[model samples]
Structures are given as C-alpha cells and as structure tokens.
Target: MVSQENGNQSQQTGGRFAVTLPLATLRGVGVQLGGRDILTDVTAQLRRREVTALIGLNGAGKTTLLRALLGEIPYSGEIRFDCVHGNRQQPGHIGYVPQRLRIEGNLPLTVFDLCGLSLRRWPWFLPLGTRFRERVYAMLDAVSVAHLLDTEIRVLSGGELQRVLLALALEPTPELLLLDEPAAGIDFHMQEEFYGLIGRLNRERGVTVLLVSHDLTMVSKSVGHVWCLKDGQIECEGSPHDLLHGDALARIFGSHQGVFGHRH
Candidate 1:
C-alpha cells in the first residue's frame, strides 16, 4: 500500500494521483431505460488509492453502473465525490478509460496529435501549440507510449491503443479513475502489463480506481475489493479472497459451475 497520510504529503494533491480519503460514494443507485429497469438500488464506496473491481457476466448491468457514475445516463440515486486533500479544482479531476475506442485508423493524426487533440483550446484545424505538444509527449511517456508519439492512430494495435488511452486518461493524473473492460482485446501478456501499470499507478500515485471487467482471474488477484453485480444490483462485496470461493462468485454470474468452472 502507498503512503496515506504523512504530515504535509497528505495535503498535497496536484500533479499526482493521490486520494487520501473516500473519494466517491454511491447510494440507492437505480436506472431505467426505455421503461426497463437496468439497475436497482446499487450502492458502494470507492476507497482512496485502492483498486476495486466490479465483476459480473455479460448483460449484468456493469457498464450501466459505470455510465451512471460517469453521469452519461440518468439514475435515481446519489453519487457524490468528496473533495480530496485541500483544493479540488484542477485539470482532469476525474479520468475514465472505456472498453473500446472507435477511431478512424486511416486518419493521418499521429499519436502526438491525438494526445493533445482533446486538451487543445482551439479546434482541430488549429496547430497544436508547443506547450500543449510537450504536455502530450509527457503524458505518453508516462504510459511508455512516447516512442509512438509520431505513429498514426490507426496503426496502433490493440494493446498499443489501450496504452495510449490510459495515458490520455491519466494526463495530469486525476484523483478518481474509472476503467471499463480495459483489457478486453489484449492477450494475456498484454493484459498483465496493462494491469501491472494500473497497480503501479494506484500504489505509487494513490489514484482511486473503479474497474469493471470480466477477467475474474486477474481481477481476483489485482483488486483489493470486489463488488459483484448481478441483474443490475450489487449482490455481494468483499475482499477477493473472501468472495472468490463457493457460491459468492458463482451467484454473481447467475450460475453454479459454468462461469467460474472448477476454478472456484
């Protein structure tokens, strides 16, 4: 675990991913779409500087919950973000990495252009200023994508693109980070590296993370806490060791022996 509070360090929260308190709280979260109930009374707390995984089978409303937290969808519940350290105002107070990024591969935009595209003040037609380009390069370097700075967006493979997206999400390092199926398209080795990077960020930078993934094996090993969502509601929650056995994980997928198989 990273250092939590050590005198003056606990008060500092800039240029780093330090979150020294419960950063997000959810209560009675419910969502309905097209008159069909998608989520019901979901409640959970995102601990500071810890990786928490949300696990469930496909169509279990995991993505819906993430969307609710992102404020992309309307929900009938309370989602609160507490002010961390001293000042809460800054660039990228919240960062998110979605499951898939759809971009035109043939677009001549280089990785450097993509990194600074969103942060640039002017429209896409304007040239990226020097300061902005340098900042983008720094962000890419954080995720080890600096070498691909001039590579076109379309040329990036599955793993490379994910790294770029992660670097973008962490530009300036947000206090709260959300990831949805971040390793969906990568192989096992790439997934390991990807998650390893996330763990390092959590431990070293103290960024609070909420991860939605189906990789039970990796999630079980990486996250400090597990929230099992089933049929749109959180069925159970605890440490990975506590919830990975018997019916705890089984029920999360609405199956007895199919999802986890003999692993459980």
Candidate 2:
C-alpha cells in the first residue's frame, strides 16, 4: 500500500478502487547486469483492472523489468504500489507466470501435487490434507483442468499447462498478475481461449494484468494499453492501435513485416 502522486495522467480506476490511487506506479526504473545497462528510465503506470501488454524485440528488457518489479533482481528504481499492498511484500501480493517453465520430462509430479505444495507450509514428509486437495480441484475446475488432476505435469499439452499455471495464480487472487509470454507454445485456437480467459478475469474479478506477448494482433484486440521497449528504454507507450501501426511494426520487428495487422 505505497502511494505516490506521480504517474500517467488520470491512471485511476473507475470501478471499486476508484477512491484509491492507481494500482501501481513505476518511475525512473533502471537496471544493470554484468556491467551492462539492462533498462533505463523505464516508467509506467498500471491502472486498476486494465489489461496491459509489454512488447519488445528479443533482449529488449521485458523480462528484466518484470524481474525488477517482482524484487527478484537488484535494480535502481522506485516502484510504488497502492494501499492494498503497501503493508506487505509486493511479491506475495502479486501473481506471476513466466515465459516458460523447464522441468524434467521424466518427473512423476502430478497437477494436484504442484498446487497443494504451494498452499501447504508443512514439511514435505507430511501428507497433504483432503480438504486442501478439494480446494485445488475447485481451482482447476475454473481453468478447465480438473480432469487432469492426477495427470503428470509433463504429460499435459502446452495450452493445458498454461491454463494450469493460470488456475494456480487465481486461487488467492492477487491485486496484480504478471504473465510472461503465457501463450508461447499454444496454437491459434488455444491462444484465443487463453486471451479470453485473461480478459474475463480482469473484467469480472477486477484483477490488473500485465502480460509480455509478441502477438501484436492479439495485443491490439485484447489490451487497452501497450508498452513497447527497445534497447532497454521505453520506445513508445500508447493505445495498441496508435503504436502498432505499419511503419512502427517494421521499425521494431523487421523480419515480421506487416505482421501488425495479422493475428498470430
């Protein structure tokens, strides 16, 4: 629950949190790694309940910025959260899904095991309670993954795995969600479903979402604001339609020419 008067003009919520300030404000955020500047002057305000997109070419510091916000990396910046999270650690108040998760294919981990472990604080030697298992199943049902409760994590398809991760994130719904390229391996159809699910959460549940994605068309269609990063600096910040036009697309992503208007 940290409040700062500085942010984009009128980046306030019109819903339940309207009386409160913006959900978050980042100002003069800079990061350096291995003697190289990863980000400089990266500032953005995330208004409550709006789905925002973070777009950039490879190595454009999108992940680095997310890491900075999560307090996973040491960086020079000021990241202030609204009063809802000011009293606690920011990481505990936010949910995150990375670009990809790597696990051994042969591991016998089940979906139930994964979710239960997160909610449980007891030693690994202790068995999980039945009541917790039921709760995990209920969350899985929300993401249409209840049928895969006993299935091995590695055995699930790409889209299924992503949804499972999403289900896990929504259980104790946080004030904000950080999704890093959540639709990486999913096909066209699955991607649509994934985007729709995110939209529903934001609109109905009032969760603020910021996702890193390369699907320009999907960003344009689903997100209210888009932040384009280049060389560790914010190259452009505006509505999806304004920043994702023809020449801007070509300038940022040369090989994916004319892809701004097409769906991935």
Candidate 3:
C-alpha cells in the first residue's frame, strides 16, 4: 500500500511519473469561439492526487476551459507537461470524461465493444485477445460495472453509460483525469453515490482529478480546491470552506438570484 507520505510527495511532485520532472504548467490560457471570448486569461496548475473543482453558472465558460486544457480547441496558452523520464511522445497520460455523451442508437456496439476501443493497439476494430479481455474485465470490475459488459449501449441508462465511460477512461491509468460534470443528468441519489465513488478513486488510486461541475453543494463535498468562473473569467479561487462561508460567493453570485444560489 502507498503510504500517506508517499502520496503527499507524489502529489507535490505532480504524480509518480513526473515526480522527478518539473510540474505541469498552464499559463495565460485564453479561448474565443466565433469572436466571443469563452475563457479569458485563465491560468492554473494541476497537482497530482488533488481534486480541483471548476464551478460556475450555465454559461460561465467552465466547459470551454476544460476543452482548452485538453487541447481540443485552439487557444492562446502554454500547457506544458514535464515528464521525468524525458519521454514526451505518448498519449495515455491524460484521461478525459466528456459531459453528455450522445451515444447513437443506430450504432451496433456493446459495453465491451466500447471498453475494448480504449486499447492503444493498432486496428481498433480487431477483436480483443485473452490478455486484452482480462484487462477489460479488470477495468469493468474497477468501475463496478462488470455486469454490464455484455449490455447493449442503447439499453443502458445515463448512469450506467457514465460508468462505462469511466471504465474506458481508467483503462489507461491516466495520470490526470479530467471530468466535465460527471454527475449531471443523473438522479439525485445516484449523484451522491457517484461523488462518493469519485472521492474514493482520488484517495485510493492517487489520480489527479479536475472536474467541471455546476453542482456547488456536491462539488464542495468532493473537491479540495475550487476555481469559480463567471463571464469567461475566474471570479474567485480557494478552498470550499473559504469561498462558501465568506463574502466571496455572495460577491460573485449572490446578486444574480435564482435557485442556483451564489456563484463562487
């Protein structure tokens, strides 16, 4: 078992893989879609084994910031991941779970089919061999969705599908896990359970998590650090206790009254 001291050191060093290397850095990050600024001058650093929550309103550019971090969208910024081994030519270090994955019913695929697709082997359509099958089963068991391995994608509910996606993402044992509202659209009870699972993963696997969430209450309970966004900018950033009990939340989101409550 990994000791707490080791975990803390791993986190301080930005995970085991990059422990000896310089930390990952994001500087002056900015993004614009169709001449509209979605993320402006956003900068942050992600440490290993730390859960960072990105919170904001419906259109506060949280999703845009996540995309920018993944390099999925063009943006002006420097995202540098320093590898201790000096091997920068790999694609499995970062794992991403997208929000609202629209799986088409017409696609003839099973849960196992999607999970096997995560393998980095050539010819993605090739059938999984015994070794790969074992790996797939292990991943399914890890996510507690082994029973759904044979289930059809079209038949699974939202929460089941999300678990399948998480299993696929974890197959690579990514150093950095990026989740965009993993609990959205699920039932209230399931949301609570899902956050608990997420918290466990962070604590046990030492996977650094950065989640973009609008559920402030849930996020407050799950994450260690919070970065609140508003109008394409960071309104406030600190611990959940610091932002919630103080005037920071009221200043950013209190004036805009609704069921959503304060912003930060």
Q: Report each candidate's C-alpha RMSD, comma-separated, in the order given.
A: 5.7, 4.4, 5.8
lDDT of 2 by residue, 7-91 (tens): 4344334433562356777878899999999998886677678898998877779889988878888878788777365722365
lDDT of 1: 0.76
Ranking by TM-score: 2, 1, 3
Alpha-carbon local distance difference test for all models = 0.76, 0.79, 0.72
Q: Write the per-residue lDDT of candidate 3 for residues 1-264, one digit (tens) a residue.
A: 010112223332443454322235566778989998787777555555778898877777877887776768898867666543233313476678898787787888988788766564769766578887777888889878889888899998888888888887776677777898887778888889888888888888777788987777888888988877776666667778877543666687775445254333
Off by over 4 Å in 2: 1-16, 87-89, 251-264
**In model 3, where do residues sit more than 4 Å from their true spots?**
1-23, 83-90, 259-264
**Candidate 2, residue 256: how far the Cα is off, in Å:** 5.7
User: Candidate 3's error at 239, in angstroms?
Assistant: 0.5
Clashing pairs in 2: 1-83, 1-85, 1-86
Model 3 Cα displacement at 92 (Å)? 1.1
How do the predictions measure up, each by TM-score?
0.84, 0.88, 0.84
Model 3 quality (TM-score):
0.84
lDDT by residue (tens digit), candidate 1, 1-264: 111222223433564434554566677899998899989888776677789998777677877888887778899978776645323323457788887678875679888877767666677887777887788878888888889989998888888988988998887688878898888778899999889999999999878789987777888888998888876777777888888776665545545456632121
